[model samples]
Target: MNDTPGWASPGSAPSDGQDATVPRPSEPADSGGASSKWSAAQPPAGQWSPPSGPDGTPAPAPGPAAGWGGPSHTGGPGHNGPHHGWGAPPAAKPGVIPLRPLGIGEILDGAVSTLRAHWRAVLSVTLVVAVVSQIGDILVQRYLLPAPVEVDPNASPSEALDQAADSAKASLVALAPSLAITLIGTLFTTAILTVVISRSVLGRPVTLSDAWREARPRLPQLLGLTLLLPLISVAITMVGIGPGLLIGSAGGVALTFLGGTAAVVVAIWLMIRFSLASPALMLERQGVIASMRRSAKLVHNAWWRVFGVQAITLLLTFLVSLVIGIPFGIIAMAVDGDGLGGLLSGSSPEFGWPYLIISGIGAVIASAITYPISAGVTALLYVDQRIRREALDLELARAAGVPGYGSDRPGHGPTGG
Candidate 1:
């Protein structure tokens, strides 16, 4: 049996311990009608060797290639070469996923599986973060944020235009503090949940405190990465639209529209490219810049796959939020008394403490469920990419103490630290 690290073929479906019979190559069979019997021809040794290492050293060939070309095809009980009719071992499943290149379904399932396995720790982190965020948002909306601007239907066109501008400005102002709160909350939850997910990958149970302890030192770097990415996107957008705004003519309107669309496209591309940086940063202990570079490297040929996973996850979370929030919203409006009337009359709803508290509970519940899934997917995607490109499954197998992959020897485990 070839037990070397990289011997397994990429994208091999995990087997179920049954002997998988491989068809013989197009060689003539004996009169007995058995395809297992091989011809007596032999091939040169170096012709079918594994690729050379970076240092120009040849990787060790995995024994005699019996079923293919290099001799040893006696088909006896003692034959130990790469023969047909023997089932390849399944990929090691020491944790939430098999230690192999993951498909989209596996990745999604792995994330949900982590949440299911470590619900206490994962939910604790997300719940606290969500509650704090919602509280801050509620307070900011109630006290600091200006009321929604009401547009008068009886007003002139200029007045309506002015009202629309004011409404936009007010909306921005109202959203700023909420966004800030959410960002900070997301930062903390990402750091802690990342630690939990990393441990979960190794099939290790983790406590909330243990995860927090491991993740605390990386918080500042994580914050930097989180803030830096948005800043970069904003800078790109400003640059794209700045020229048109400076010109400020009728043609500039068209230019601004085009430039803004282009900028948004670029921003989305860059964001998807850097999406894996958080898990890279948290798991690899990389700097913000180094993590971004690592993410770019990992995502180079997999942009659309990564983007598709992220988009699907985003849609799922959105749906979850909508499903959970609608009931709470209606209840809040009913309880608050004024919000229902405002909704019926097609105006901005005035939210009081009763409405805010009820709605905040729904937001908390939605966030608690969604946060872990999002973070888990990102972390698992990082693991999946590394396994595909770098044979990280071998290392993971060893770390997870799978029997055949040299688990008895001392080695570095996959860890967030």
Candidate 2:
């Protein structure tokens, strides 16, 4: 999917914050084909034993122990098979994910489950963001947008084409402020919701205040990161089109189209690769550049998986928005008649505040529901990547206060549930 090593992230530093005597394991527990993808590495009951010390004394219970299948992380004591196949203890549901690798459905379900469990916090963040974004869009549409140059129904073809071009130009210009608002609001909400989702994964209650306090300081960098991606994308796209413009021939035009398409493909790839940046930055407290680097790294081995989950999430949100917006759009059209058509077409036809307000209301409703889903999926994806790479599942388990796990270990905080 990538020409270079851009998709690869630096492996997390393997550390020992668990019991001193029982060494931390580097590899993960191996669950063979029998178990489900996201199933936990369930040793038989009482198999989680502490390792023996150098002098043969039993070590204390380990905290952030090794991943599944690691040498140090063999069954602790009174143990049988290291990886239980049949009748393995059921995966603990203390948090969103089992204490193991995550399946795609698990990630998506975790996002929705968090929303269901903590609707108050998720909806609160999204409500504010949606209002802000809808208001901006409405203002742009009503005030800043250029009046549509009404195309003469009987005009010559060239004249109508010119009018169409102008209308498109006006529409694009009008959409700028709305686009900016959406991006900024998404960054803000993503930050806060990442914290919410992180806490939710531990089955801990997270307040809006807690999310904001943890996320607020990273707002500026998040803003930078959000803006940078689009700007870089646009620049890359222009590079694709520039040569065609320079040549200004039919062949040049064809080249430009091909370049633009190629550019779009690359841009989407980059976006998916960096999709986990917000979660990484907000949770890891990293700077924008470092977070992006980390995201690219985490996305390395899992590009297709990430892309699939993101595409599914994107499809879901789009469907929800469309479902919510359609009835309101029809209502607006009925209420405002041809004026609604004229407004959309960039032509003036007694523009009414009622039409804009109704449409904006629909948008707000849709946005409020969709924002949390988008943010939650991205955050969970980041967590999933860390679990795969750094054995973050153990850390998360400890944070969630799962028994048999060490408490207050490094990289696991903000909850003791």
Candidate 3:
């Protein structure tokens, strides 16, 4: 790995901290039905030996190694056959997560573990971003956004329809500024947190300064990726609903509904496919397009799995936000002197500074807690996918200074006589 916390593309040369003498093996070709896809220099089953020394002898065990797959792992000692004893050894866990394919629960736990273990750095990064985002939101709400559109229940049908249209437009207008602020905030937070989580995986310590220094160079590419995804989704949506919208008739409305649903399905599939792009960009030093392509490749065989984990994360975060926000929301209403009457009557309350400030606090707290989990899952998912597909745990072990994995640093490795 690089000092800045990155890995080389799969099947490529080792990165900065990896030993150059230990070359990575090329991956098998995908689904070509030709035996040539398999490497010709094959060891017989259960006869694979670990890397040998200069004398062509199997290197001695590197003194009491730990973790799954033994100390010198190339898919563990059991790679070629089933375990014959008390089962496989536990995977090496130098950091927040085990250095192997991760379970969903493990992925979620790993994110939370990083936050707990490095609360200061994680919270510092998140709190700052959330506070700034909320401040912009409060300012926008207070002075810039238009008041909610008032529709009279007694208005004629045509008048009511007009009011509804006006309301929709107003809602979009109000949402625009806040969403923009959120996008910018997420960009910064994701970049920084990725570095933090990556370090944590190696069981290494990191500070906010370290994370920022590592992440700063990649911010532009991250931003471009962030902006591009939404635009792509929007373009897909417009393409789906455009014709129906143009017709402006009841039939057109039905067509729009059908088209929009299909478009949403496609958009969602694409989003899940590209979900790992941000981390790929941040960690691989990849460009915007390259990172996206990398993500698509990683997600290729695991679309539903990725979608399921992401959905669970989304649901959990939403629940957490609601739990944290509701009390603050109620208090804000009480403090703002609006009471619950508006809520009971299905009407919007006019919020004052007290309400905005109090609610903003809730938003900040919720965001501070949720950001790490969200970003961590994405980064770890990227790691997990690579581990599954490319046998990246070996590289991670080397980078983490695990014995018997072979180290690049002089004093870190066992010296051969």
Candidate 4:
């Protein structure tokens, strides 16, 4: 489904083993597909073609699936191209994606495998972040936050509503500490894990120390970019409904609703547009604005594809979090319900410290596992976009020191690198 012209149709790949390396004559291009960064950057002579033999005959396409089209659609060495229905090759996985664009399943599986293979290092980073965040949250919930103030039963309805609003405001102010810490933690963890996942693609070991050292320099920019995104979204939302709020009438209310709906749609568009900025920043060593611009460029005309993949990854992580967190939530409710006086008063639903700690355990476990998956998917999406647009697989192979990729001669391989 990749749209590089002059590239052979991976769809028409042969079922036979040997000649699967040969690029069949070009078929009609898949115009509906997103144009790749690779194809856009390429010179006319640079698109991959069958290698000429020593005697000037065409040689086999070489060195695994060569195009960012991602594996082959027919049988070939180290590939099951024909059996795959989606034109996705099943080869070069289990933390394998750097050498090509990715299948959706491969991206998910690669994330899982990276976590599985480097559990110690990955867990160390995430455990520290998660624990710190959870502890801050518990402290805020307990000592700093007031128990919800009870509404006066005998008062007017308006008085009760005002009391409830005051209680909500106090709780939010108390929550500021935890939320602030969590935001910082997420930025650092994303930076470190992006390093770990990139190295993992090359089959390299990354210690927590190694990840930290590499990730440290870029932290400021990453933090800025991360914070900037939400600010931008909020600013747009406010600007959208600002005029309506000033009017204070029926027309204003209608205008506010319409403006808010439009704002939501714009916010979603911007979120998808900039989703790859983290990876571009971390892996490419790009500055905040540059990375965001890079992300926007890669995501051009591919918003839905990026959104779908991100949505699925998020759903998977959420389900996993629920699986671990639900039991702990139940236990916390059961144990803390009887002991807390607030239960009878109904001022707050937050359980005592016992509940906070217990439930926090589930939160810790879930965050530790899912953080890598989210980070990996984002990083891989950046890689996939590059493979599509910049022929990044060839460069990746060269970086990984893959055999034959170093030579650009006709006999060297399918990448023609």
lDDT of candidates 1 onward, in order: 0.76, 0.72, 0.81, 0.71
Candidate 1 lDDT over residue span 225-247, tens digit each: 98999889989998888887677
Candidate 3 accuracy as TM-score: 0.81
- Using all chains and alpha carbons, the TM-scores for the candidates as numbered come to 0.77, 0.76, 0.81, 0.71
lDDT of 2 at 335: 91
* Maximum-lDDT candidate: 3
Rank order by TM-score, top first? 3, 1, 2, 4
Higher-ranked by TM-score: 1 or 4: 1
Q: How far off is residue 153 in model 2, in Å?
A: 10
Candidate 3 residue runs with Cα over 4 Å from true position: 10-87, 152-164, 339-341, 344-346, 407-417
Whole-structure CA lDDT of model 2 = 0.72
Relative to the true structure, candidate 3 has a C-alpha RMSD (angstroms) of 8.6
lDDT of 4: 0.71
Off by over 4 Å in 4: 1-95, 146-176, 248-252, 338-347, 408-417
lDDT tens readout by residue for model 4, 215-235: 888899999998999889878
| Candidate 4 to truth, TM | 0.71
Rank list by lDDT? 3, 1, 2, 4
